[model samples]
Target: MTRTATIIGGGVIGGGWAARFLLNGWNVQVFDPDPQAERKINAVLSNARLALPALSDVPMPVEGKLSFHDTIFDAVQGSEYVQESVSERIELKKKVYAQLQQANPGVLIGSSTSGFKASDLQEGSPAPENIIVAHPFNPVYLLPLSEVSGSPRNTTETVERTAQIMRDIGMYPLVIRKEIDAFIGNRFLEAVWREALWMLKDGIATTSEIDEAIRMGFGLRWGQMGLFETYRVAGGEAGMRHFMAQFGPALKWPWTKLMDVPEFNDELVDLVANQSDAQSGAYGIRELERIRDQNLVGFLRALKERNWGAGKVLRDHDAARAAVFHAQTDTAPKAEPLTMAHMQVLPGWIDYNGHMTESRYYFANSETVDAFLRLIGAGMDYVAGGHSYYSAETHIRHLGEAKLGDRLVGTIQIISADEKRFRSFVRIMKGDEVVATVEQLCLHVDMAAGKTVAASPEVWANLKAIAEGHAGLALPEGAGRAVGQKK
Candidate 1:
């Protein structure tokens, strides 16, 4: 069943919520009094369109409908979920919640308030049991973390159901067992932010230097292992317990001014703003955002390769998406020479020659194999069961070049197959032109035993059927070609 989400207050956070829901196949309705709400949300959606899909190889669900409304009642009337992202003002939030409840008494309400606790949001609500804090970080479409908390009045079911919904939309819902100010993530962020501010106030570091300190050092570590685990590694052979024992004495060293607040008067504000401008004002905000998005894509892809931390989240999400794709395609008529893959050449795939590099052709062919594996029901579960196809031999012929941003598609024709072995040829095309071809030989492996094995009866039957269906087609022109002629 299609789901609907209504967003109130189409600012950065609200726009992000819209993107997250809409891209995940939820019809989104947005209500913001500001005249520029539509334009701002559209801009966020544009960035999301580029960044989100690049995170996974599996195809995403088709986008849901998005409609902008002038009033809260119209937006929330039929929505199953209502996300409130208006200003941080307490009374404003209360007003919105009241309106939302009046509009749809049974719908769940989640507030995108980074600072307010769920109890605070529930203070004046008529339907407090349905309201929860679903605070998400900026660029919510890309980042998976969402801090969720429910008030005392909220039922346990509400929180769990909200968490499941968040997971469906590719978000990690970190539920706060008890409500507290700033939730969880922002508390840690606040500590760092306060230290940075104090450093700036004391003239110890410029904005760029502070940013460099994090990005060039701890930021990379935090992306995967986080602070405590990184420090655990620092403990040598002892691990986290010993590390804390060794470093615990420094707690009173006055190393941080966590309790101090720098006055936000004009002089300090100007000083910080001026330094920030001098540091990064060369590029406009959009360019900086694009650079940030590209860097995130590359970093996340690296982490995905290792299946660690956020990368693990991405891998699991990809598997789920692939499962859905397999289910949908399994019932549909199989296209002869199955269209196994379709994707644009990502920026990282390009070379100095302004075209996709040689290695990427192999990467594309590997993706075709993955898609084919899923199509035949030998997917994640099959691999998990200690059997999988291992490539034994491959021959590739690069016939043409593909540039960045070119849409590439791969089609596979089964050349031969049996219980223990399969061989296939994959042709990659840029539109109608053949860009490359790879002929691959694969053996079914009992992974634990480290040797070839016959595939299960079901898998063998599926492969045999596909091979027989394509038996009448003519052999590809270069099917048997070698590097040297018979001269």
Candidate 2:
């Protein structure tokens, strides 16, 4: 069944929620008084369309329907979930919640208030049990973290259901067990923000320098390992307790003015704004956003490869999506080899010759292998069970070059398969032109034992079925060719 989500605001965060839901195949209805709400939402969606899919090899679901409505009632009429992203004023939130409740008493309402407690928002409200805080970070469509919490009036079921809905849309829902003013993520952010403001106020560091201190230092570590774990490593052989005992005294030092907030006078505003301009004023907001998105995509993909933190969430979600895809198409006949994967040539894939580099062909072929593995039901659980396919050998034949911005598709043909080994050919195409071919030989391995082994019976059956399906097709021209020519 198709699900529906309604967004109450069309600002940056609201638009991001819309993109996340819409891209995940949820029909979206947006209500905002801003006359340009549609334009704003579409712009956010454009960036999302470019960045989000690059995080995974699995194909995304077809985009769901998007509609704009002027009245809040019209938008929330049939929505199963309503996300309120209007102004942060409590009065405004309460008003919106009232209207939302009136429109649909049974629907769950998630408010995107950064600082307001869910209990405060639910105060003096009918159906307060249905309202919960679902705070999300900026660029919501790309970032996976969504902090979920409930007010005192809210039932446990409300929060759990909200988290499930968030997971369905490819978000990591961190449920805050207790209601707090700013939830968890924003509290950490607020601390950093306050400290940064102090630095600016004291002339200790410029905006750029503060940003560098983060991006070049702890930021990278925090992206995957996070604070306690990163610090635990810093603690050395003794681990977290030893490190804390040694460095805990530094917490009392006057190195940080975290307890005090700088006054937001005009002079301070101008000072900060001027310094920010000097730091990054050259690039427009959109250009800066693109740069940020590209960097994030690259880092997230790296983490996905290692199956750590947010990358693990992405990997798990991709596996689920692949399962649904295989289930839906299970009855379909196998005619041509499966069009397993497709991707655009990102800028990083270009070489000195201004064409897609050789390494990317191998990467694309690996993704094709991943698709085939998923099709054969060899997924995370299969690998976790100490059974997996390891590439034993690969032979590549490059016939043409693909340039940056070119869209490439990979097609897979099963050549042969047995209990312990399998071989396949992947053809890389730019549109209809064949650009390259990769022949791969793989061995099933017992990961724990580090030795070759026969695949599970089910996996072998699936591979045999695929090999038989492709038997009628002509073998790829270069299927068994060697790297060297015959003497």
Candidate 3:
């Protein structure tokens, strides 16, 4: 059965929520009074379709249906989950909730409100337990954090179910211990925003300078290690306690205006807005959003390569999806080449010629071959058992170009196999076009003994069965061609 999620607004954050849920295989129903909601949400989904899949190694779920509705009742008709991204007015939110409850009293609603507490929004609601805070940062399709805040009225089941739903859509649900206005992330951001505003109001720094301070310095640290860990590393040999004791006195230095509110007059607003425009207003808003999404893809992909921070959430999600994929297809040898891997051409994969770089072609081949190995039970677990397959020689031929955002399928043919060695061919395809081919010979080796060795009985049976299955098929064109050989 296809799951459905109803989105109550269609602004930047709401559109992001729609993309996130839709891309994760949930049919999305949206309700917003704005005439341009569909166009705006489609714009967000376009960026999402490019960036989100780049973060995964396994195939993403087939996207679900998206529909725009005129009324809350229509949108929330059959959706079990509802993400309310409407404006931050309490009465307006309550009004939306009343309508939602009327349509489906049991529907779980997650608010995208950054400031409103769940208790405040739940006031006078017939189904208060069903309403909870699931505030997310901007670019919700990419960023993983979703602060799941609940009040005392909420049951433990409600909170856990909300968190699980967020996780199901590939989000990190940081359940707040206590309800607080703005939750965690926005509160810290508000402090920083206040300080930055003070600096602009006092003419101490331009908006660009403050942003540079962040993206250039601590932002990089916070991206991976976060605050306390970064400070612990900054403590030389002693760690966090020593560092805090040493620098804790600086709290009284009055170097920051965090406690002071900068006057919110038009003068301050104009100062910040004018400077910001001068800094980044060359590009249109959509262009800036695309640039931001691309940069984030590169950054998050690096973290994924290292398996750290938000990247871990991505990896976990991919693993879960891969589990389902493998379960659906048994380990038996197929009559044709096994579809071993699926991938997207990420931003980092492209080069100066606007084609996928040479290294990624090899990476694609490795991904396919690795999946085949895993299927045959000679994967990382086998390596940990002190035996593994090592590639002996490789020949790659590039036939066509693959550019950024191109979806690629990798299929592997087992040419021949024995106890100790096998030859495999991989075809990297974009739709019906074969863009590249990689042929390689691999040797099973005893790692401790540092020599060729026979494969385990189970693994050899699987590999041998696969090789035998391909024995009747004609050899792939250019399978044994040399570097300069003619077609």
- Taking all chains together, each candidate's TM-score versus the true structure is 0.81, 0.78, 0.89
What ranking of all candidate models by TM-score puts the best one first?
3, 1, 2
lDDT values for all models: 0.86, 0.88, 0.92
Q: 407, model 1: CA deviation in Å?
A: 9.2
User: Which pairs clash (backbone N, Cα, C closer than 3 Å) in model 2?
Assistant: none
- CA displacement after TM-score superposition, residue 396 of candidate 2 (Å): 11
Model 1, 1-487: lDDT tens digits are 8899999999989999999999788999999999999999999898887788778666567689999998888999779999999999989999988888998898898999989988888886777899899999878988888899888788889999999988989888999988889988899999998899889989999999999999999998998898888999988898888888999999979898898889889988888899999999999876887788878888888988999877888898888876765553332224368887775676567788879899989998998888888777788899999999999989898889898557787788888899999889999989899999999999999999999999989888888888887787777768867776441
Candidate 2 vs. true structure, TM-score: 0.78
Error of 2 at 305 (Å): 1.5
User: What is the lDDT for 398 in model 1?
Assistant: 84
Native-to-model Cα distance after best TM-score fit, residue 48 in candidate 2, in Å:
1.3
Q: Where does candidate 2 stray beyond 4 Å? A: 329-487
lDDT of 1 at 357: 91
- Model 3 over residues 420-466: C-alpha lDDT tens digits? 99999999999999999999999999999999999999999989999
